[model samples]
Target: MPRETLFTKIVAREIPADIVYEDDLCLAFRDIAPQAPTHVLVVPKEPVESIDSLTADHQELAGHMMLVCKKVAAAEGLSAGYRVVINNGKDGGQSVDHLHFHVLGGKSLKWPPG
Candidate 1:
């Protein structure tokens, strides 16, 4: 388990989220602001500040996040292709402190990603 984080509140059902997939370790939900036709935010139940904070001990959790992203994407009919993104620090465009992977697809995405 991790220290208190916004994601912890969301996972604890303290805040509402349009959840798509969920297990003991993570949760996938629709993004409030969709960058693509299909956009979902996959977050770990544990409190990881950002990708930069992941340590060797978090390898399994990292792998699990990828696996869940694939599963969620497939379930959402994104077999053709999809983009998985993890924004790092402020320079990387991280808004929330909680670590999350954005799964985007359901349409052709352009380069640069804006």
Candidate 2:
């Protein structure tokens, strides 16, 4: 079983979030600490621990998440461009255990982000 993280709570409606989008497979909400003018976190409703926990069976879920990110970006009016980032672990700057994609845009983002 996957460990329940803060994201899981949000998905379960046990915690409140500035939700931007939601579907049967996933949910998207605004990040509490915005990195850019627009920062959103797209996560699967089914907890998956982290990127390291992904398996071949998750192939379709992974692709679907990316599509959700794109949809969110467009809804946010990020026609200029946007960045989709998934941090895997502690060293990778993953503060949360649940796998999630960060959609950041609305401003010029610096390259080689730490």
Clashing pairs in 2: none
Task: List, residue by residue over 1-113, the lDDT tens digit for candidate 1.
Answer: 55676678889999898999999999999998899999999999888988989999999999999999999999999988999999998989998889999999999888887
TM-score of each: 0.93, 0.98
lDDT for each residue of candidate 2 in 1-114, tens digit (9 for 90 to 100): 877789999999999999999999999999999999999999999899888999999999999999999999999999999999999899999999899999999999999998
TM-score of model 2 (CA atoms) = 0.98
**In order, what lDDT does every prediction score?**
0.92, 0.96
Instruction: Summing lDDT over every window of 10 consecutive residues in candidate 2, give the lowest-scoring window.
Output: 1-10
Model 1: residues >4 Å from true position, as ranges?
A: 1-5
Clashing pairs in 1: none
Task: Return the number of clashes found in candidate 2.
Answer: 0
